[model samples]
Structure formats: structure tokens, C-alpha cells
Target: MRRGTGRRAMAYAAVVVGLALSGCSSGGGESADESAAPTVTQTVTETASPTETSTSPTTQTPSGSITPTAGAPAVDGPVVAQDQLSSPSGNIWCSLEYGIECEVKESSYQPLPKPADCRLDWADNQFRVDRSTGARGICRGDVTFTEQPPELTYGTTSVVGDRACQSTETAMTCWDTGSGHGFRVSRDDYQLF
Candidate 1:
């Protein structure tokens, strides 16, 4: 009878150990499945606020058009009208009231010969000033004037001016008040002043 009781107790302990091991194994399997399961992830994007965007100033064009925060230099002087260009030398006149003048010259100092065929022709804001060597013609564009002359590129040359000029979508114009020397180009109709 005593041997039989010991065998029964040993059997019960074995059964308990087997159950505990099975439970642990099952728990590990569940944990592995949870780890392998797909997880939901989210992403977010942010945009700048108006106040943050407005840190830079706005630029206004000669045509009364406003470009928002382009960071372009502001025009220091008033804009001259297209029809107002005039020169004291009667060669080219952009605007006398605006103090903008253009003249044809042989060199930096020498004026173009009399009857200098210095004339301005334009299509919209785009213009070509025809003149003798060193002669410049002044004209205005549809865009607003800036302190810095707007970039007026012609062929391989990048036109720059000492005086004020404005840039537009179609074209740019400069007063060329300093040297009075026009731009040199192969074409008879080229942007100079």
C-alpha cells in the first residue's frame, strides 16, 4: 500500500510539470505571433504658416502687379511711362520728368553723328533701340521699376545698367543714364537701354 501511494504522488507531480511546460510553450507561441503581426503606422506632414511665410517683404512690379515674397530688390525711384522717354540730346528720350535719358554715342563721350537714326521700336514691353555705336535708347516696360536694373538678356550678353530699370514677364528696360552707351548686338533690333 505504501509503494502504491508513492507511485500515485509521483504521477501527479509529473502531470503538473507537463501542464506547466505546455502552458509556457503556448504563451511563447502567442507572443511570437503577436510580434509577427502587422502593425499600423501613421505619418504626418507639416506646412508653413502665413506669418512664417511673410518674414520676407513683397515686390511690386511697374505694371501694378504684386509678386508675393519674391525677395527682389525694391525700386528706389518712380517708374517712367513708356511714352515719356526723352533725351536732352534729342537722340533718345525715355522720360524727361523722370530724369531718364538715352542717347546714341560714337564712344563713351562722343555723341552719335547728327541725323543719328536712333529710334525705339517695341512690341508690348519688348523693345529694340536702334542707334549708332555707343548710342543708348531708354524705354519702360510693363513691370515695375526696381533699384537694381532688371536683367535684360540679349543673346549671349546679360544687359546691366548703372541707372534704374524694371523687369517684366515679357521684357526689361534700363535708363542707361550713366555711360549712354547702348548695347551691341548683331541684330538691328536689340535691347540696349
Candidate 2:
């Protein structure tokens, strides 16, 4: 699905826009990858306590334990999507092939440690989740910010299958279509709800 150049980001860097992010970069397409993700120990607790924590998810995933509390939670709206995406500033990027996987080139918040079972790279700046699931860091050897996919214009969003990602001036917000729950990431911090 990595077959194109990135487009320019729009002016509304703070607004939340949404569209289907196919690989074509014309706001079309769906997830084409289905390899089972590794189990991640990060858990999604329904409790109001953001202090909750756990052990793993299905490989670089967020299903085992963790509460998302980065900045004040703010999920404005949906953004268009492609198989992959770049934030307008090029500081963040994402891939929706398997739910939504995103990473920030730079951030300020301290993230959870790598799940014990994760053998790949585990970082606080790396985020991953399935549609309808809570957000967590990803344990991966690859990155989504390769600039191979189209850029998700500021204020615009990209969605493939059950996932959607929105690029804004402050942070990139993405969520699972079924649960409406997702996470937000930026150069300074991240939040999951």
C-alpha cells in the first residue's frame, strides 16, 4: 500500500476533518494487511482512574492493560484516511492497515514500558490500537512516518476500515469506529480515552 507521494497539509491545522484514506491519496481505500498483531500487555481499563496499568496486547497492541491519560482528552471529529498518513507538519505519521498505528518523531510525555512479551522496539512515542479499542504504545521494528503515504492535511482526517486518524496543529487524533475511543499524540504529549 506504499505507492505514492504525500500531499500538502491544509490551512486549518487545528480543525478536525475526516475522509477515507485509501492508498490512492484521493481519500479512498481500506486496510490491506491482516497479519495478527503481537499480543500487547497494555490494558484498557474502563475505570475513571487513569492510573490503571497492565501487561500486554496482541503484539504491539493495547488490550492487556493501560489507561490513556496524556493531555486533557479532546476528540473533536473524524479525519479522512489512507493506508498511511503524515501529519501536516510532518512530525507525526500513521498506518491504518491493521487498525491504526501512529508515531511521533518527538514527544514530551513519559510512556509505559515495552510489554514483557514484546521483542520489537517499544517506545512512548509509538501508539497503536484496533478499531474500538483503547490506545497504547506499539512494539514494532517499523515506522509509519516514512512519508510513503499521503499527508493527512491539518484539520483533515483519514479512515480505513474501522479506524480513522485526524491531523491537527497540536496533535494527531485517531479512533476505532466501533467504540469511538482513541488516542491523541503530538510532539509534546499523548492521551488515550
Candidate 3:
């Protein structure tokens, strides 16, 4: 019995020593200094999302850089009938003086071959429309179109009698509205249609 008690006392001493050296992970073992220490945490939130409001989309017209528009062009001023008009760049001049006609101060197209019967500075610079000669070039010593007419803003159409002329960013076009015959002229080329 004495030998058994001696063995038990040695085992109990070993358990006490182990318990003192081992880590106690529970809150019960945390000291006041460790428990009082603060832990830092960071959180982020976002606000302000982008939003946009839009309506009708625009369409591009044949005239370079021109956006198609609907309804009649806003009339900022009176539109004179049988009046003259120039392109935005003033490179072209057109008139409703006698007929729907236009002329480029400089052009690349072949000038009308001067006829032996005709005496004038043969000019391919001018193009005009008439019922008989749908559209044709002129031989002129000097005439209307190159004479610098009033400015006609793009997207605006001027009508006088059966003739109409419209200036655009890229070209100037004139026609006999009733017959649908016309000419379109730009700096380098012209079309009589």
C-alpha cells in the first residue's frame, strides 16, 4: 500500500508540471493586458453609379459629315425666292436667278468643248438644269454663279417657282423640283442628273 501511494504522488506531480507549461487557449487563461488589447478591422463601401439619358439617334446623309434632320429646317431668317446662295466654304456659288444653276470657282471635270459656233470663255465650271437640256455645262465669258451669291446654310432648301437649290457641307445641288432634274457640284467634280 505504501509503494502504491509513492507511485501516485509521482504521477500527480508530473500532471501539475504539464498543466503549468501547456497553453490555455480559452478566455479563462487570457491575462488582463492581452484581453484589453484592441484589434483593428477595415471595411470599404462604394456609392455613386453612372447613368445616362438619350433619345433619337442621328443618321448621316450623302453630304460628308452632314447629319440627317427631320421636318423643315428651322427658319432663322426669311428665305428669299429667286435668290442667290453660296456654299459654307464659298468655294461654290449657285442661283435661282434664271434657273437652278451652280458653279464651282475651280473644278476638275472636263470643260465643255468650245463649239466653233459659240463665242465665249468655254467653262465646264458651271452646271445648270432646264426642261429641254436636263442639265448641262456652260461656255461663258462671265456669268452668274461665280459672282458670289448670298450664303445658304446647309440643311436648308430654297424654292422659287419650280426650281429649288440646297447647299450641303460636301456639295451644292439644284433642280427643277417638278421634273426631278438636277445637278450636284463640289470642288473637284460635278454630276448632271
- Provide TM-scores for the models: 0.19, 0.53, 0.54
Worst 10 residues of 1 by lDDT: 40-49
Off by over 4 Å in 1: 1-63, 66-74, 88-91, 94-106, 109-193
Per-residue lDDT tens digits of candidate 3, residues 1-193? Answer: 5334555565556554534433253447643344222211011011111133455697533223222222112233334453788888988888777776677887776666767866877666677788654455676666674357778888676767766677677777777655667777888776666
Where model 3 places Cα greater than 4 Å from the true spot, the runs are 1-82, 145-147
TM-score, cand. 1: 0.19
Question: Which portions of model 2 show Cα errors greater than 4 Å?
Answer: 1-81, 141-148
Model 3 CA lDDT for position 54: 54
For all candidates in order, the CA lDDT equals 0.32, 0.59, 0.61
lDDT by residue for model 1 over 31-57, one digit each (tens)?
233432222111101111112334568
| Best-performing candidate as measured by lDDT | 3
Clashes of 1: 14
Task: Give each prediction's root-mean-square deviation over alpha carbons.
Answer: 22.4, 28.4, 24.9
